[model samples]
Target: MFTQFVQQFGVTTCGTMVWGWHGRTLSSGVHHPQYGDCWLRLLAAPKAKAGGKLWDGPRLAAERFDGRVHKAQMYASVPHVLDDFAYLAELSRAITEPVCSEEPVLREEPALPDRWWASLQTDLDTVAHGTSDRVAVRQEWINRVVPQFLNVEPPQIRHWAVAHGDLHPANLTAGTPYLLDWEGFGLAPVGYDQALLTAYSCLVPGFVKKVRDIFPVLQNEDGRAALLVVIADLLQSASRGDHPELAPALHELARTAI
Candidate 1:
């Protein structure tokens, strides 16, 4: 199916295969006769589960945003039904730089330069301050989950800002930084991205402090609310065996924040 998929693009794979969660998506680098290099991602899911706002995120991002930061440029996307499943194939300009980390949690502190940090601070601010009616996290969902996950009523989100939705270490590039995986980008609580990055970096206290210093909003009511929301979400994921190693640290952070 992938060979057939690439045949439509007139390209050939050049790099190692990368798989998304549960092998639902497959991504790799491709070399084109005219386009040189590009990224190809194919998402396979049941027909009923494939078409939605999140499914269209990369295309929407390409149409709506550019120059806000370094990111992939979508050249083409084709969605079609294959047997009982729906497949969405997206072709984008390849990012030559490696990601900061291969997974959400960083095993060690990243030795990034001042400009890299500056770019992240500036880019996140730019995106968060933009106006968007789309949503990354809903109030009703937060209200329902926070109590179950953290045993506390959700904080009223006083500030709602556009966000990347998922901004863990793996989604960001090293050296020259670029944000990846736009599938969850939309309106979320103010400082949601910063809070998420900090929450996932619980093992690295020094890096967490640096993030706190860079974004002083983490100390404000709105940022605190966002942090609580992110921690609650992480706790929920921990319960489900996702990043179970962070469970203890997350509980400790929850105590500090609460």
Candidate 2:
């Protein structure tokens, strides 16, 4: 079916494995067996069309097994998607060079629907300030930790660029390091991404440190606190179902948060 859809497009492969999770793909090169090294990807349509303009790489068009039209973006290597703090630091410095006519990598928040912010609030309130079950801890965190560190109001989250919303190693790729799966993308403080990467890094070593270093805006303590909130929310929502694999990770996250 894919062959028929991409018949004249010189498609190289179909369903070739690439790094991804949820509904988005990171990188999947379709190598034309007869066309030598010709290859490309079939990226799904981004949740936010405006976000696509911020994408930094080659682009293509793709269709799903169900005949849904999708944009296919190409990348030379997905490994570049991995968060390498050292490399990012250099890139940051290069981009900050004054008088450079090149396209400035705009690090700004994307417009989001109002309801999305409300949904995140449930977790933010539970984690940042705790619920009725542990008001003292929430108070302590707010008075002693959250304010001194995070430095942002719970309702207003415009201090940082748009976060991937759902960030994990699975969303990354080695061929073209594109941050796929924008369904959860939204505006938040810098610590949100750091916290997420830190929590997930417990299962995969070194991811936390690199994410922190690359995005130096996050304080270690604040990042952990923010992460605790996110984990708690994720545990309560996505992992709350009967998925055995996530049950334990969810419990652990909930316990740690409270």
Q: What Cα-based lDDT does every candidate model obtain? A: 0.87, 0.35
Model 2 has a clash total of 12
In terms of lDDT, the poorest run of 10 residues in model 1 is 61-70
Candidate 1 lDDT, 1-258, residue by residue in tens: 677779999999999989988898998999878878999999888998987767888887777666666678888899889889999999998988888788998778888888998999988988887776678998998998889888887888877988988999999999678989898889999989999999999899988888898899888888888988999899889889899899788878777677
Best by TM-score: 1
Model 2: how far residue 178 lies from native, Å = 5.4
Error of 2 at 194 (Å): 2.5
lDDT of 2 at 169: 43
- Candidate 2 at 185: error in angstroms? 3.7
Model 1's alpha-carbon lDDT is 0.87
Alpha-carbon TM-score of each model against the true structure: 0.96, 0.40
lDDT of 2 by residue, 13-125 (tens): 44454433443433343544454333333334323332232232222111110012111222221211223211000000001112101111112222334443343333333
